[model samples]
Target chain A: MPQTLDRRRLLATAALGGVVGATGLGSLAPEAAFAAEPAAVEPGAPDPNFVEGRISKISGHLLLVTGSDTVLHSIRITDGTSIWKLHPTTFDQVAIGDGLYARGVRLPDGTLAADSVWVNIVNLHAHIAAVGRNLLHLDHKGQRIVAHVVPGRSAAVYNGTPAISDLSLLRVGRHVQVLGAWHPDTNEIDIATVYAAA
Target chain B: MAAIRGEVSWFCCGTAWGPCGTAGGGACGTCRSGNYQHAWPNTSDACYAITHPDTCGLSMSRRTCGFRHYTTNLCNGSRVGTTIADCGPQTDLFCGERTCCGSACGSNRIIDLTPAAFSAIGSLSVGLRPCSVDTV
Candidate 1:
């Protein structure tokens, strides 16, 4: 049956969910689809230009990491932070204990401005296996990652709201990019995602 | 939240009023029983803001409630000549014929003027364009 609902209450709920004010109306033209390239080794890691690290802490939204080369990096999650384009995933997939691989223009403060951080240290394809209150369960090549959808804050690529309630729309066969991070205190990933299908 | 892309002329449900797409609670195709619906948020309906408790007005072809001195009414004008019915919050249904009905109220119903033609009974022109009809 076609779903039905009250107009005022539903809109009120969306407002509570933080729907940004509306702007000018316009149609969004679809981008041309293309075949994706195979994964090549993403350069710029473990050096001054890049870094591979296990998450030391998730101090709120900021990420503290100790690099594989034995260096400490403080990463900021500011509004303009460019999440890694390679992984093509949203920030909702990041966590505290997963391994992080980042590439970006490093700041002089010895802390790198990360372009992207791979959660779990390894790349994987995942399907949106399930969704609960605030957690998204994903199956990646026989592995599972529970990604959290951070409310209110707009993710890097998905600025518009996502249709998360009806997870049934997320079929099992769809492939998504997976990134991971580690948390020293809990030694677990705090976020993850099946990258918004490339 | 449906991912609406590019520039599209979306409107309220069951009515041709607007470029309203997802702003406010109107956009999601949700309408209350006996109320109206818009797009986005995808679940409920909003009631029409009416003027004069019985009549309304239309702005830029969309419906709107009353502004200032004009007490909210269901129909735009009570004159015998035909015009549009002004629904509040910027909604107006066009009327077809002219009738000297005792009361000028059109409610939310778009009335038929004659057997062959019809025009809305309330005020048809008011407010600016899209902004009155559509959300961002």
Candidate 2:
């Protein structure tokens, strides 16, 4: 355990060093580090291979989606397509009105041959207003969110420590970040992991 | 360009459970949930169009696959370096969304990191964090 902690410390130090080196703040001008925009593609063109939106209709293996930007898409799910809600799941678990982020190849017919589909996955930074057995009441941008902790699956990381299944270290009134699957049409979510400062 | 401040979040890819099962790597086909990697909003023109960070009054340069970036959590000052393995966190979807720690606040979704990368600097349960992203 001592060795593990030492290693983590070393890694943390090295990461900090890398940040300093990248910024060149100590010896170099900030503009020197900031110059030159990175490479990019032309603007306003549609990404032929990715889509993010709400599922308006589900027909067989096809999902009719209306993007947050209001663009329409037809997403085709095949046997190879991976689906995740709270965790990895299947096509049958998907429902209408669920938000989705899909990545795949664009077919000749303009359908997204989805290789992966994540439904209602949300990451929110919130304050842990209260805690109960297997539950956390969160305040996200002033909105209340009920976060359910699933033992054996949900985990917690305090400060920058490695993740662990024990969430006992979590405290009320602390700011935390939660990554989990959002229950479609609800303010609740199944906690996958919670990040908090110890 | 210099590092830009905004929010950072995590997503699953490569090997995992639930909907992530079929995610097979990521857009770059090299992303894994356990790897120190990230999804950049402007990986390509089409990617930029979809994320449209500009809609939130932020401009991000287009970077392709394998680009390396460094992200720092403002709250704890922890940092992580990751490679671009996908396109991400459609910015415009949550336009005007803001997150903060103490007096430090940030708005807009600029980056989506894999579980591995995010956990390096922040916890996954605390989904959104005020962060700064830069090329390294």
Candidate 3:
């Protein structure tokens, strides 16, 4: 936790310098900056171990994740752990408006890594493969995926698709994407984009 | 100009015996392999021959980034990446023997924008020439 916090602070300081645009202060040229633009490097392949999912439920510290293959993830967020040097909070302190990027491990109890957590402030893209009563099961590739919609955020459904008796709509074959954080434990992602992919 | 190159075959800290010659192999922690090993882009190094005629060096690692690329060493039979540091000798933290600094491995290649500029139609696209090479 302390290490994450320190990295975040350092990244924040670097960002501040970047925004200021001072020449001698490591001003990143536009071309160079574009080249270094951060992109998600999917750790490993489509293994459930290194999957990045959305938070569907947060019961205490456990995050039930429901995307990129249905799997319950055990997440642990501590003070100062940051991604890309950004400090985003987890735990009960986290809410619906978040995203999660995690590195998985096979714990002795058949759970996953309690380490390497990233709560994204921005939503991501995923293809919805299934939908259920107040719950949408998604798929990225052949993986079975799912998401839980918050009440006020329910409008996120494509054209406000109701979440009841829509099991038919949640077909075995469909494409839908989502954007949100994966709870540290449980590994459920908050729904951000429940739309079609082009 | 002598076009030289060097490469770090593999680097990982694990109990595995023998070189996997690739990162992330043999349960090693977050092993990095490939050409994109340097943290900074557009960096370059000179390659040279090792002072000693014998000895294969250790697999080099980079703190700034992940992965290593290789080329054939001019003096030794070892194949290394085409970087200035790879051609030379001795030992140190970043590079030893014919190995080169991983930071300058991939970036040494000349920047090519012919495909990008030629995307447009008409003679205007053909006239697009790079003003100069800049390092990052």
- Considering every candidate listed, which one attains the maximal TM-score? 2
Best DockQ among the predictions, by candidate number: 2
Per candidate, the number of residue pairs that clash is: 87, 26, 57
lDDT of 1 by residue, B102-130 (tens): 34312221211110000011111110111
* Error of model 2, residue A102, in angstroms: 0.8
User: How do the candidates rank by TM-score, highest first?
Assistant: 2, 1, 3
lDDT of each residue in A79-181, candidate 1, tens digit only: 3233432234556666665555443344455555443343443223346677666555766435565655445321321211232422223444454433332
Candidate DockQ scores, in order: 0.01, 0.06, 0.02
Candidate 2 local lDDT, B36-96, one digit each (tens): 6788988988888878889889889988888888887877676667788888777765567
lDDT of 3 by residue, B36-128 (tens): 121112122221122121222423222122223222222222221211111112222112212122222221121111111111111111111
- What share of the reference contacts survives in each candidate? 0.00, 0.04, 0.00
In model 3, what is the error at residue A43, expressed in angstroms? 16
lDDT minimum window of 10 residues, candidate 3 chain A: A27-36
Reference-based TM-score of each model: 0.27, 0.52, 0.27
The deviation in Å at residue B89 for candidate 1 is 51
> Candidate 1, which segments miss by more than 4 Å at Cα?
A1-47, A55-64, A69-124, A128-136, A149-166, A178-198, B1-136
DockQ for candidate 3: 0.02
lDDT of each: 0.30, 0.68, 0.30
